[model samples]
Target: MRDLQLYASEAQRYPPESVRNHMISNSIVPIARQFNEDMDALRGLLPTQTPCPLPARMAFVRNKKSLEGIIQRLDHRKIAATNIIARYNNGFHLLYLLANLSRLDGFRLHCNILSAADGIKALSVSQDALSQTLSRRHDALEAELQGQKAEVVEGLQYQGSKTSLALASLESRVHSQQQSLDELSSRMSSAVASPDVLGRMVRAELRQQLEPLLHRFADVSLLIDQIALGVSKKASEHSDFKTGGSGAIHGLSNPGSERRVIYTWVTTYRVRGSQDGYFRFRFVFMPRSWLCSTGISLVFSSGPDEFGHYSICPSILPIQIIPYSSPVWDIFERDDAFAVRQLVEHGKLGLRALTEFGQNLLRHAVHDNLPNICRYLLRDSGYGTLFLDDADMSMEIPWSLIADRSVEDDIESTREILQLLRAYSDSGDDSGNQSEWGWNNIFCSPCLSFEQKKSYGHLFLEFGATLRLFSWIRNDDMELNKSLLNFYLDTGGDPNQFAKTGIPPLLFALLLLSRGDIEPDISLVTILISAGADIYYIHDPDNDPDTARTTTDWAFALEVEDLWEAALEECGLDIASVYAESDRRLQDHRRLRGATRSGVDVESITEPGPSSELRRRAGQAGRRCEEGWIAE
Candidate 1:
């Protein structure tokens, strides 16, 4: 026992250096070697400067895999080293020095591991950034092409119209010349003194007049042919131009070039024609968030297939484009803050709305989970607050979409999202406006009935979510709403407060029992009374005919039971008048239900309303006196 105790006890004497050195060599040296290898590999993977677009896809993928492998391997090493340093004890005085050295080495390893992780993130952001750039270029080029195409179609129509008008004028001149010739022939025939001489005079005059007119007609026909040929040549040139046409407009011909056809004209060219068709410009991307709509889409449309209607379309361009060249979702998934920041800094993905506010890459972040990327976007990115874009689906917003969602972080991340919003609340936004994104209305969504929804509701309270609660129950939760109800009461929700809805605390409780019925849970009623609910509760929706129908309006009609009245009396308030009025209304079921019409007869005959088609057909067939009336 003494030998065992001595072995376990702390040794005051210094252990020999040789023994400690062997232990360190066996354990710590391998870890140090691995740390160096990982660091070297990571440094090699992340380039010193950001690639403009990105390297070839396969090369990028290879580097990405290498960086990720280093990160994972180093993470495992970090954890193993931490455990070793924590529990290391050989009970030798000299080994303390070794443990301390190992401790310092572990710190260095951790730092290297973090550095390697960041490189992985940069690689990802670069990839996403490149993809986004190419997509934007494609859209921009297509828009320019469409604009140029519209101009061509319009120019051709205008030139064709001028040609047609000239042809009409030439034909009119020919008809007038023929009329003059015929009239002269008639007069000559009537006034002739010599038949052979007169006949020769008429023939000579007709041929002379008709010759130049025919030539003029032939000239107009030739001009029409040239115009048609020009159109065909322009079409072939268009095919080639598009292949190399990235952003080059006006590739057709220089306006001042003498090479222009003597017959060609572009002086009156206007986009889509002044009187041509109009377009309702639409975007081609799925808007990603309320604070952003950064989608890369080509919302193409085919307009009226007529000449003047050939409106020139202009493609939309971004103001502050997202510059991330790679997909960095891996960074978000890891929740690595440093790596996320690297991506943000390197990619320059700040407050960019491809068009305007309430459209960005935020939806992508939330779709995965709450991560450091969201933090940079909401707090660090200078975006201020992510305002709700009404144009998007409600699921795009954090409050409505997340806590009730089936994400990995579940309720915890959902709360963090709300807290993030709280930190970035817009001072310019009106918190009192319950219909929008703010305190008064922190998403009373149907999705609020989620598992953690009751817990999620408390986040709103922490963030200063106000409730009119006529004194209680703010959560959409069925069971845990009691806590929220009390939260409202404790936080100064007025139990007797009546508003336009006319639902006081007392009647409001009864409405909670079910959808159109007024059955109050006694326990809940007592709780309301403790919170200072009015026992009388006189003025409700029942008093105002103009009031919109509400659940309280339905509840007040269910006759107040003697038990309820007695309970109120015990609380030192009389609801006798309320009971009597409710009883009177309840006696007449129709009156109690607030039936819109006085009679159930639908319309009371009203001088025999229009007959049903079936009934009309029956009457027409009525005892048809064997008449063909039935057949007719």
Candidate 2:
């Protein structure tokens, strides 16, 4: 009704006398009807005496008259929710009633109060209450309470029997097992620890434990003769073999063996504070023909000494030896073999381009760290061709690239590959998106320039990118959101984007959410989360009185609180629910980052796989980047 009045006012149109009279009638009559309907609904739900009090009665008369005047005047100012609420002393009651009705009807009433006077705020709720609700995390508390109840009940039931027997048995069994477990644990620990008394103790125990089996074996020469006989018997099983073909010996059949000889050479490098960190070489199995055609498998380690190097250990076969440096020569010896003939028949060009790019940046020219680069690249090169931007300062081979091993260790190359495919590559075709903006267009590249020639410095550019990302996400610009998300993960996009901008992604996300513009995207949220963006907890430090050193600032926290409450009021969502979700995400990411920093195993880090939806958005962004325009 207030919206109607506002529209009338904005349109500069007042209803005719007949229309005004009708509106006046409806305004006065509708409230009374609403009051009666509400009272009827709550009669059974609340105390019977909770009707309009004396003060409320007087205010209700004023409210009644104001509604009538609003229709007669056809003025927007007189018909907003606030004036009506103020006119009626029971404004909160009216609001509460309307809120209940709206919820029951499954409709949203963005107006502050369903009144016929005074401008209605889009949302309502005292700021403090909102903050408490967002911060309290009520759901977690409820779950905790429920868990406690279950645990307490279990404890009571198990106290006398389960608890007692478990305790009694634990100590008894622990005493027996402790000696062996502790010794074994220590002995195993010694292998990774120091090599002295403890190490010798472990080695002696392991070797002595296995040596007795060797003594039970038959005489060496007699056993060899028997093994040879077994090898010949096994070779004779092949239909192609003659009755005595097992004795051909050129193929070197051993005692009960069907073994093929393989030899590989591996090399390793050193790591800081560690003995092993090296690259390795392996001879992967290929057909004999492939071996002659240079179809050899070549594997190299990206880092230092890795696990599982080549070794020759014959169990029950006669082995042939070739020159260690020339494993290829050994394959050439089988040129006349059937496997070699098959390779010549099929693929003359046996091996695909085989170059161990290794730590060489040139060979691995794809700088997966540049989503902005792809954006920039698409500007010049067709979207079908994602060009690598040399201008990206971060991509330039840094002195620290080789010098900073610690930083390098933290980088996951596979993640980069995944991010690149996610951000730049089009799913439908192998080609990238087409170019729309120019090669040097600033806006085309989503990333801030690290080069000094750009208007904003590197840090500010990063900061702006963060803001744009938040804005896009908030607007539910899925394409932009996806690209920004990819940018964040792939480029390690600016964590401190808000550092200079004075506005973080969390706050923006909350603000947009409050405005009822968009819902949250957890993927983008996850990226910000990993980068230390938290809505609930702000890193505010206090200033020292003596030194005047500022420890932290809680301004962000206050802003978040204000925005959160406003959002709750706007969205009509449970304030506690939103807050709990925020805290859970924030705390989880903080813990995740902490774990990574504390040297937790790489395997432990949960990999967020490619979101198919995200890929779709990226594909769209790629197309959008090709067709440049203002993002609505």
Candidate 3:
């Protein structure tokens, strides 16, 4: 409402149609887009069940058709949500949709979604509050200013009366002093009979004539002394220079004297409103005080790092350094759960874009070792998925953050964070959400130090993280040692565990060894065999030695056939029989491949080629493999 008037006042510069268009495009359009985004986030959190069986999910979609209608109305260029767009019906629809999110328990979530809810409510409340503030009858700042001005006027009137009295007294004292001067002049001219009599007579006349004026001078000196004493007391008791957001003017002297500026200030008020409004930006100049030779252009950093400016303002646009309000990031450091929830729940996490802390807020909390806050963000607050922002390792999920060894070692706090992450993993419904599978890919990228890997690797795996650790061969960190692998096994990582790709770690490690990234060690092969890696476990019967070059080929490729045989022998399996069985398996694979191409049901005709009991045990130890992970 205030913006409409503000733009209306710009009539001399912009056309009426252009002004309205600018308001709609600049103010209303952005607000509507944010509202739509908040809606989408709420929809994502909304449960499928109508009754909202779980608030933890964020929000349940109450009506898909209505949601689509709103989306279609709002998508990209076809915006309709505004004050005067469609016979005023558009606003009703928006309000109703917002209401659906509030009051109803289904609209609220314990997580970041609540921020969306609070944000929606704040939107409504802020609109109403702003309207009231802009109304003609409700000019709080102007009214207060007017009231102060009235007191100042009254004080000035009283000051005028006191001035009049002081001037009158000054006139009376001047007349008295003039009368004494006349009497002294008269005494000096008076005649004396004898020489002795003349001297005595003149001195006696001077004393008699000057007594009243001398007493007046004494009284005047006492008054000046008293005034000086009072002024000194007042100066000591009170500060002369005052500063505030409104504005403060300070100088070296009072009015009508030479003034040196202690500080300089200027304010701009709403020149078009019914009552003068105080919506302003204060620009306090510190030109010579703070600016250096190059300070006007370049900024110097004294801190370790700085969060970037998350503004829409372009680099082409000139920006001035002005006083800004306390940032939300600073507020996050307050450690108040209520304040944190207030920020997250009020849609700040979802709706606000420009106000986003230049860093990943969740990462900040984790770095500070605030597990309780982590719990709120990860699970309770509807803060959305951790894995989506994969571009920045520092800003996204704690996969790399947990691997950061530079952070102070507080195992107890770290353990709590692990527990929170585990709970977050379990509560998440990963049935169709493919992004949720990012949780399972913990150990895949071995980017952390060997010590870091040993410290948190086991805990991550044990606390619900699966051992789907598979990084590309070139990116593999070859520095990983035997102790770390042993730690992973001791904690919970079972290479023989249930998985789709039963690519045995034994073969995976041998492939790494063959790449010559790490120094070859027979113990690397021995360690896997000791940890229950099935050298005889073939994931797929079709993984033939000749037809498909698989990890199984790596043993022969690296000339580790001796180590492979020894491992089989140690696992109480016959090397001769295993090789013979592998040969038979290769032949059967070819037969099956040919039969399948000719439209035969290979599964129906598939049979056990060898009757050996040892082969059956190897098959039992490992079976599932499509992408080559072996599991018992």
TM-score of each prediction: 0.32, 0.16, 0.34
- Tell me the tens digit of each residue's lDDT in model 1 across 1-632: 13222322322234756356323223544565576677667656654543323453335456666766877886676666555544556534434543564466457646654554565567688779989999999999999999999999999999999999998876676544433432111111133245445335534533332333335446433333333343333333322211111011122111212321111111111233366442333343433232232444322223432342543563344434332333454555676667766755786443343322223455556545565666766667655332222123211234333333442255566556666655544322222333122322332344444334445556544545543543234433444446545555555555555543655666666655433333344556655655544343333246443443332244445544544555555554445444443343333333434433355545321111122111111221222311322100
Candidates' RMSD to native: 36.1, 43.6, 43.5
The best candidate by TM-score is 3
What C-alpha lDDT do the candidate models reach, one value each? 0.44, 0.34, 0.44
Off by over 4 Å in 3: 1-360, 363-369, 372-409, 418-463, 470-480, 497-502, 537-546, 549-552, 562-574, 594-632
Minimal lDDT window, size 10, model 1: 241-250
Q: Can you write out model 3's per-residue Cα lDDT over 526-627, one digit (the tens) per residue?
A: 565655455544445465534543334557877767666665666556666756665555455566653322355443222322432322222322232222
User: On residues 306-338, what C-alpha lDDT tens digit does candidate 2 reach at each position?
Assistant: 244443432122111212244332333332233
Compared to the true structure, candidate 2 yields what TM-score?
A: 0.16
Between 2 and 3, whose lDDT is larger?
3
Candidate 2 positional error at 263, Å: 32
The window of 10 residues in a row where model 2 has the poorest summed lDDT is 430-439
